[model samples]
Target chain A: MTGRMIQRIAPDALAQLSAGRSTVLVSGTNGKSTTTAMIVAALGGAVATNTTGANMPGGVIEAYSRSRARVAVMEVDELYVPAIGASTLPEIFVALNLSRDQMDRMHEVGSVARRWSGYLDGSEVHVIANATDPNIVAAVGTRSATWVDPGWAWRQDSVVCPRCTEVLMWESARWSCVCGLRQPVADYTVEGDVVHTLHGGSLRLELSLPGAVNLGNAAFAIAVAQRRGVDSDLAARRISAIDDVEGRYGTIQVGGRTARTLLAKNPAGWASLLPMLADDDVLIVSINADEVDGLDTSWLWDVPFEELAGRTVGAHGVHRSDVALRLEVAGALPVVDADIHRLAGRLPQGPCVIAATYGSFETLRGRR
Target chain B: MTNRLTIAHVFPALLGTYGDAGNVSVLRYRAEVRGIRVSIVDVLPGDPVPATADLYVIGGGEDAQEMRATELLRADSGLSMAVHRGAPVLAVCAGMQILGEWFTDGSDSRVAGLGLLDLRTDRRSVRAVGDVIADTTGVLDLPTLIGFENHRGATSLGADARPLARVLHGIGNGAAEPVEGALQGSVIGTYLHGPVLALNPALADYLLTQVVGDLAPMDDVRAEEFRANRFQRARA
Candidate 1:
């Protein structure tokens, strides 16, 4: 496989290849691929990036090797951020919100935050972090960084203060701990489709990506681009051009039916994506418990699947029964079908929303 | 008349790291299938722990949140009184670690547990993470239990405690004793975090039987399929 070859040939290739490039490292539990694409689009000048979600160090090396660009924007996996950051010495490091993702393979949220804190401590690298996420604030510490409050949606992983281990108080759109640690004041604030920056004043960002999470990603990407000397309005306009970031929010024609593919890997992702579903939307949830997908489907219980109670639900993929069971328990009647293509054909003739995990999403994307 | 059963999910916002909240859902669903009226009370941090619930369920969480949950649970005299009154409890992973007498963090600092179970957990250099298949011969009336285990703490049971299962496949308890979890009185603790009960229906029925005595068995095709899939994946 190409990955194995890349691992063997150039284990430390990422460092050497990205030496002279103005690298922007984007790392997060979700929206890494989309954010990376948005940043690359905003830069618009000979930027090389891992647009297909191969986000490990080797992937970064491969992306750099395949391109003749002087500027590199790569999506780094959250666990690999420290190692890659140390190697690439990125000009801009973006720390997005931290939440529970792939628990079987990934470190706990607190552990990840601690690792980030250790990596960022006293480092001179300019960092962009989320101000609303307590974990990100704790990780960034006193590091000189541009903090932005795009709005915090998933609070389960950030309820406990990372510094004091005390339950944080959430009020007035901000989180404050009893131990005196609180959400930092943002240099850039995202309020209702507008990004308000400290220096450039306010710029209205009309992003093509749906959901408040995507808007947050756009705000961070535009801030990073602006800091790198890109015009703020131009950056926003370029980011808005990205309607689909590698199959996300894109339409796939399968079995004579066109389905909109949306990816929800973990409970937090599902919490954000499920609300975007329309009331009459025909929903197809595909789950796979492969090695890449964490092999644990218990998080299905944590998702508010009851939101799909009135919708016609169809479960597809390797863990179709598991998805059906969770939906059934949540008061929805889900029809289980292992064959996704066949399931697509059997669905009523209408626009259907396909929510899938990482592996399943890739399979659907490949089909497209 | 449907027998009423109340299940308290303790600190789900804090102690729900590995989808362990599914364990509570499994218990509620299994109970409802047996013609029992189920009511779930989510006891969050700063909320008063209900003194009387038929069952109490706690899930896994991060080390910091686990320590915080232990502190809050220890302060709740109502939970202690409920355990004293023979209420059944199911705790998983970090929840199991905190239900014990004490848990030591990675930095060798120790925090006192709820003292509901006579067990102690110490951090280990190697975090045991993978698929786990345990022999629940004596603990539950099931031949084999399937789940996933991801933890760093090596738990040891005292004289008054017994292991809920033997580690048949993965490294559980992180001890040379070949044990998985501890069982004391009506409390069950385990590191298996496939929402263990969801993959093993008999285990859910066993916990329900502790409260309502004998229970009718329902068709468990989905549970059996889940167990088979997990076993296959574990072997692969």
Candidate 2:
């Protein structure tokens, strides 16, 4: 509501409000909020950020309007990057991995990549991008970029080379196309828990957040911190202090069982979060068709739900039946319930991991 | 008949943007549930599309991958011969477009298709995206076909192929008459991808019947509940 009012009252509010601060814009299909939080925490000073996950122009204006911090780290939405970049004139523009996300609204992944490529082509905005992702490589095409290997696993949307339009050959961690479009050599690479930097220094990222994706996000954070004149050791220390980004990965008590909330809004997100689940963790997945969650539930099939075959599963949300049906196909019989609050009684006596879409995750987090 | 069926998931890595792969899973599940042995062959870009497969499934992709897939399929000629031998093929969105005579790219330039289906696709001024319901009363003998349509191509069918379903709600083919999909003998093309078959089990049964002849019905109560909820929600 405040976002709409800010846009109406001051159309160029973000530009005026962010005049003095050194700003950093983080935008991607997944891990935007978490990465923004990581960067802010690693930077350590009084940094202005959209901690509530408000990433659009209006939200950004509100964040800037509320804080007097000299350093600002904003989570910019993929669609709003071009406008936000122009307004803030950020020193460091971080482009994380891009893949299929909100297709009904975002259209296609390639279109977004093309827009980023056009915007950042010759601009002097120091781009720190994921070298492992083909779309990120294509987006920052030939530009002088401080590339980091964040390790992308979802290759469905990146099968065709964006440069030469040939089918890309991905052999292990390296990928190349016949027409010369390939993965960029990363300046910073994350091997296991350590981030190997270009300068002969390795920082061990002992993050409190679960999943290998967070480890990659920490590597990006450390690289951004290093560019901002912060030591890698200092940045890693601050980043390790963060346990949860806005209620994600936070545990809440529910009907005598502990439930950990993990937010996975797209296929790529689910791919990263699904592997972090223990084999015997009692699971509850919630889905919604609200505007934020993308009305089409077809992307559920793209997620490999078969991995949870032997686990005790429960489906909850407005679209619980859709989640239930997907689980059924994958040989995991799910107990369906529309309300998540009522689902706690049906869960077993293990650490219940609740994987939810955007709307459902917010609702679940609020109840805690 | 044979007790075994080989299903070809064509260009899975390329044309699998949406959850269109669920169609292949549905086909395999339905066939196996009926005591039929099923083997799936994932035909990537460089691999040969098997002509001897009993059924084939193709999915939606980006414009570049769609065009590339069409060229590879045309060169291989495996899908064409399989369709000629009366093998049931299900193609979604971009997959449907590539089987036609031609379709436009992102820049609105005409690119040649495999000529498997007698139709052509041009770019639409506005992309049709939302919940779409179709009336397939006579075509597939199903009640109120429900699926989500997300595409920018306006397809015009030639004389050889016929409309698969009449759009009751959202834009389907974006044609003069509200049609959802195109169908030629044994080959089906549609923009609906609630993986299409998962939401419409009867349609999956129809495709399975084409290859394995008449089959007995299995219990699909859970699937029916899913359809019921989505159909209600779409109507609401």
Candidate 3:
């Protein structure tokens, strides 16, 4: 739906909102935006979302201001934590790992955990949480939760072990806890790098979006939808038909070239998109401190740029100068940063992609 | 004229905000700009705490992270010896809480800390997010560090380690000054949201001197220019 349609039709349309028409609330430190968009498509038509992607109260207010659908599948940031909980906390809540995110704005993972725990405490709600996380599964799960669904994605990414607060063992299959309590979680499995629910059948979390994390998100979306009483067969069917999540693994066609569009906020999100690009594809990036974008941009590291190999990349943003320079320092090949217009045009000459964090997506959405 | 030193760190994975990395990063960056190396050690706990590392940093995580970090640190006699030998460590948020004799878990369970420092941590109520600044001997121009407090626990000062700053924003030692942070040896812990090193450069420089001493060389003319330019732009 266009931004204009959302503003004008979203509110009045809610009166017609139905229960089977599921609205999934994707909450966590990372991967919420891309996952929400992908899962929305997985749920098929009759769904609307807020792409302003603020994750705060004002941002959601800005989103709901425009969206119209049977289900209001929305994203929530930690700053808007209390408000979202107080207002539009959907019937189904899919909480990704409560790891540390923007420390400048959101507190560490515990901050989110503590907040979510109390909010969810004693509520007879369906919670799709990552079971492998010691915090979510062990500590929180030990509490009285309605239903527990484990995550299969992000089993291999470099993350903190819940116990040691150190990097968990990045095993070939999945990560291991350093504290001896780390179990070899085999049932919590991933195929084609996607997390699969026990009942969601064996179709790789093939939600047109690329990345194991997306697959985990797909699983969570499917799980949440199921909890909201969507039929298992229909939810499964709808998820399989999914084919996009917008700028987050969305695409653009400029002239004869195809540029895969990705929005990377932190090094983790950056790593998720890097693997999908061919070594020879051209790349564009944007970063900034706009609004609640969490002004601390030091997280650009931790993204193993070496994994990108020798691909040539170009970038732009309000912090274009900083983004450009950091890429240079990290040994990335630089391209021209002549405004988003120039970069958009030059980007599609080769197999290319555009990545940005902050409202930089406006340039992409407006261009389309 | 001596060059100001500053160290900028990308820390979220390290300390997991249990909210201490802010103080660590803020203090280091603020100090280094005045001229200190401020070696940024992305030390994953239990991996080898680098020998004689000038400053140690950690953040909070799920009770699991705290349990694991404390256990891992306890297992390492060598690292604890290093900290005991007078290494200037700056921990914030969760970092400071884990330094003392013990930390209570989510179940109101208690676990032993490194004992290299003295302090105690206990899980508290849920709603702790608000402006926090502590009144203390160490004066900073910035008002109470503006950040949210989303932790479910609270720390109590022990006999040895002292409360670094009075509770400024939220509850510190049940309403004391320079509250959410701690100070023992060179260690300073607080719930200051990374303390945001780029904005508070003075504290950053102070942290750098702890590790690299006062004479370390840095060649980032652009970073200096960038900091000055950003600060200037904000003012203008």
Candidate 4:
């Protein structure tokens, strides 16, 4: 709202607000909010950030105007990266991994990469990119970038060469296309929990955030902090302090049962987070087709719900049946309910996990 | 009836967007439950497309991958031969477009298809995207077809091709004809990709019956309930 008022007064308000500040902007299909939060934790003091995950141009402008600090770390939506980059002209542009995310709005994965490549090409901003993802490598195209190996768990979107359109050859962890587009040598390679830095030093990232995905996000945050001259060990320590970003990985008590909430907006996210939910005796998943959640729920089929076969699963949301159907086919019986709170009452009184899409997650978070 | 069913999932790397690969999973699950031995072959770009598979499933993908898949499938000619041999084939979205005579690419360039189906696809003024409910064309014993449609082309059927269903809700085929998909011989193509067959079990059974002649009814109560719920929601 502040962003709109400022923009109403001056059209180039984002540009004007970011004029003399040292800003580091981050954008990607996943991990934008968590990464920005980690970066903020690493660069502790008077640092301004949109920690709430409102990553659009308006939200960015609002963050910049509200902060009285000289350094700002903002997470920009993948679609808004070009617009924000043009306005902020940040010292470093962190290009995280791109995957199939909100296809109804973002359109194609390749299209997003093209836009990123167009913005970063020839621009003077120092680029910190993901080396493992073929799409990111193609987008960073010939630009001198600090490549980080955060790992690419989702390979369905990156099967074809972004440049040649030929099938890319994936031999274990390495990928190469016939057009000579290959995974670049990473300046920072993550092996297990330790990130091997470009300077030949290894730093162990012990994040409070669960899942291997968070470790990957921490590597990018550490890279951004190091670029800003923060000590590697100090950055890792600060990053470990962040337990959750927004409602992600947060917990809520429901009907005397503690339900850990997790957010997975797309297939790649579900693929990474589902395994973490495997140990839970009971699980609740909510999906909504609201504008924010991408109205089409067909992507439900892309998720490997088969992994949760024996667990007692509850489905909630506007598209609860759709999710239940997908689970049924995967050999899991899912109980459907539109109201997540009401549905949680029916489940056994014990600890459970709730994984939800954007709109549903927001609704779930609001109930608290 | 063949004791073993080999299903070829063609170009999964290139064309398995939108969870369309779930179609293959559905086929495997439905087949295995019937006590029939089933094997799934994931045919990638450079791999030889098997012409003798009992069933074949192709999926939706982005324009670039769709274009590349079309080229690779065209050169392989295995899919066309399988269709010739009366093997059941299911194609969805871009896969449906790739089986047609011609379709537009991402840049709206007209590209030649495999010509497996007598249809041509051009641009829709607005891309058809949402939940779709259609009535089956009586070729298969099925209930109301319920799934999701997200496509950019308006497909027109030719003399030899017939529509698999008539659209009751969403904009399907993106054509004035109000049809959803095209069918010819043993091949079925549609824009519906709730992995269409998984949502519509009757359609899966129909396809299974085509290859195995008769199918034993499996427990599909949850699937039917899901379909009913979505159908009611789509109608609402």
Candidate 5:
């Protein structure tokens, strides 16, 4: 019910949305929240967004109420994308990448892919999309949406081909065919793993998240910043300065102690991030199935956890026992385990790494 | 003594983004666990395409990239040779799109492919975004709920090739009904991004086996460890 009301109210901003109101809508699965947040963070104005990560219909309405910023930065739900309606066509549209996210809530990616099918058909608004995603690749040139980050890179395991079970190929994770698809891949990057995109001359960014996906997110943000008339170099510099979104691979310090914290909500996200964990550090890992983190944890069977190393380690969360059992099955190096609340004081005196899924962080954040 | 595996990644050039580098980290982690070392050789647009590699990987890209990379591969005259020699090649998303006979962008402009896979691709979509699930099929496991279903075109497999998976979500061949996955030779294709190693160890095992098969003991032990770490961290 609330979802319908918000859709009705979204057009309320149309009066304020000047033909002059150039805006950005960065959408996708994992990176949508962080990438949208990064755009909102660096590009100051009455930037509106759903930073709480409520990408559904109500969240979009909530984002609008939270800020009257001339430039709106918001994350769009993959399933609810159609709910955005016509009033919210952003002046600048950005997509980090198209991947399967929550299953219980939405149809297959192709459901939304069908909606954006016109994306290949063409776009009047300045558009930004990851060059690597096939759905987006298929759309380019037709709608004339500009492709960004055309380079040689590849995702592991990969998005399967619908016809054959084979994985797609890559040159660099970046590639763009002139099939009439045109967009410049972001080149100027800020230090510290942040990307500064200069699309239409505006600038925006301040993300420290790891993963080539985040880098693409930052790059897309830079492109939006440029589209909004932000300075390119400045935007690039701003992006490289930070390190994370709250739990989507963020780092945190707890108990007046130095510990980097991060969140991995699913198998794909975890797969991309797990390789980066420091082997030498004492680590505390957590998991939870709160709706925000996707209620099912069975995908846990899909992750590659043996990489934790031979150091001291512990686990906790709503599914703590299950996690422990998996660890035990792996014959992991044994150590004393504690729940999130009991972790800080019990942690070894060293640079500690606290990692968790969605609900686990609330408990850890209080300890922080 | 450490066993180091040299990896060669063939990235199709001129696509939209290069976020696919995540695969290297996944490969490196698996190798590191068994006390193995990984050295990477990132082969990009301008670089020389190698004829043989221990493991071959390709990522997603835009339509423009498909044509550019495909043209470059055709010009190289050696990539097909490498795949023919059974170089366990892996392609994801748009990379897979380009490997087939042709892919027409949304504009209906068709670009030719290297034709390694007996399939044809076109830029058109019946769906997009969110939980694209597919059950494995054919030479591969016929049913696996892998993530990622964001593509505008539909892929149609040829007589000789088998599908990578059956579509549990998202459209597979531009047809309204969900089909299976894309495949050719040792290569498997999909749009389900994220370092696949993190979630589906089976996929990781397949890739590792093709490369360091006997050298790596990636039974349930590796899968267990990977899951334990992520699950542990997810716990608050």
Candidate 6:
């Protein structure tokens, strides 16, 4: 309702309102909301952001209209980054890893990377990019930017070089293509719990968010904060206080069982989050095919569900049958139940880990 | 001893855009359930196409990646020889476009395809993306083929090609003619990428039978239920 009304009332309002403010646009397949929230918290002092997960243009306008802050940090959708970049003239643009996401609605990963490359070429915005992802390296490698190697786990989208189409050569910590494209030397690198800078200084990050991916997100957020002259230690302290971002990685009680809801939207996200689960964890995988969920469940095959081969699993949501079939093929018998509360009741004792898509996660999070 | 069936997944890294790799998983799962031994060989770019495989599968990709995949596939005569030797091939979306005579690239320039099928593809102004229901009754002997269609290519078939199905719901080829995909000899190509084989088990079985001869049918209640649910959702 708010988005439509804002769209109708002032179609050009975003361009007008963002004319004088210095903006930072955060975009990627995953971690946009969390990273943007971390940046907002780290910057402190009247920083405006789209906390409602409305990263689109209208939502951005509504967010800006609601705040009187001069500095704005906004999460822009990957596909809409070019348009938003044009209108916002952002001071800093953070490029996270690119991967296949919502195949039903999104363009292939290569096309999106190429679009980002076109926008970044000859532009004055300072780009903070992931050096580990070959797609990101190919996108913004030529331009001078602050590259960070937070490490990438999902190689399916980066197996073939985006520039030369040759198979990339993968080594222990870096990857390179025979055509001379390679992961850039990082201006900032994450080593264990500490982030090392090239200038012989480092910040030990203590992130409250779970998973190595969140640490990587914090590393990027710290880099952005450092560029803005915010104290690195102060930024790390601020980021560590954020335990949850927009209901992600939050514990909720349902049907007398405690569960931590983790949002795994794509193959890359699943690759990062699945390893955090223990062998005996009660796993509930939920899926939905609504407009936000992309209406296609074929990506389930790409995920390494075989890791849960010996575990007891529960499948819930509109696409429970699809999830059940995937799990069954992966050598696990899954109980298919559409009711979340009922599924929660059947979970084994101890804390459960619930991995869900966008719609399923939102529905369960709303119940809290 | 059970006879082992070898399936070649072509350029999975380049051509797997829309969970299209799920098609290979469905084939393997269905085959394993029926007590048939299966071996999957992933053929990456620059790798030699294993011509001895019983079946070949390729999925969708981005335009640039598709063009590169077509170039690599055309350079290797092994796939063409395998197709000539009667190995069944399943190609989806961008893969389907690359198996044709030619397709439009990013600059609207025509790039040559493998020419295994008598078809050509050109980009349309508007992309056709939504739920698709096709009537494959006579062709594949399936009830109602259900899947999701997302493509911008307007493919036209020649005399040597016949459509695998007729579009009953969404746009198929995005052309004035209402055909879905082209089928030539043992080669099948379509834009339906619910990883089409997962939703249409009969089609997977048909491709399997083409290699292993007539086989007894196993219970496909789960596949049937999945199809029914998707069909109902498409209607809704």
| TM-scores for every predicted model | 0.95, 0.98, 0.64, 0.95, 0.54, 0.95
Which candidate leads the pack in lDDT?
2
- Tens digits of per-residue lDDT, candidate 6, B92-197, equal 9999999999999878999999999999999988888888999876677666777888888999998898888998899998777887898899999999988699
Misplaced by over 4 Å in model 2 are none
Compare the candidates by DockQ and give the number of the best one. Answer: 2
TM-score of chain A of 5: 0.76
Evaluated with TM-score, which candidate comes out highest? 2
**What does candidate 3's lDDT look like per residue over A1-368, in tens digits?**
54334436664332233233445567776777766765665566666676646565445555554555657677887544444654554666766665445545664555566567667774544566665554554334444333333334433223665444555665553456556535333233445644555554554443555665666666666665555556545665676565555556567664355667777776556666777776667778776656545554545534556464344567577666555434544456555564765676755356677777756765666642
Clashes of 4: 0
Give the per-residue lDDT of model 5 (tens digit) for A1-368. 34446558665643333234455666765667777876875575566676777676567666665666666776777655544534566677776555444433343444456666554244466667765666554434344455565222234323333222223443544433333332235443433354433333333334455555566666666667666767667666666665656554545555566677776665556666666665566677687656666644444544556665455566667656446544543445434345443565576667677777766776666632
In terms of docking quality, model 4 is medium
Candidate 6 residue lDDT tens string, A35-61 = 999999888899878998888887888
Among incorrect, acceptable, medium and high, the docking class of model 5 is incorrect
List of clashing residue pairs for candidate 4: none
| Range of the 10 consecutive residues with the lowest summed lDDT in candidate 5 chain B | B12-21
Query: Which whole-number lDDT from 0 to 100 does residue A24 have in model 5?
Result: 68
lDDT of 4 at B130: 80
How many clashes in candidate 3? 65
Q: Write candidate 2's Cα lDDT for B111-192 as tens digits.
A: 9888889999999999999888998867876767889889999999999988899888889988677898898998999999
What value does the lDDT take at residue A194 in candidate 5? 40
The sequence of per-residue lDDT tens digits that candidate 3 reaches over residues B130-187 is 3344554553333323333445556667666666556534565442233656667766
Candidate 2 vs candidate 6: the lDDT winner is 2
- What does the lDDT come to for candidate 5? 0.58
Q: lDDT by residue for model 1 over A103-208, one digit each (tens)?
A: 8788688788888888887466899998888888888887678988875458888878899988899998788998888888899888878888768588887878
**Cα error, candidate 2, residue A60 (Å):** 0.4
Candidate 6: C-alpha RMSD to true structure equals 2.0
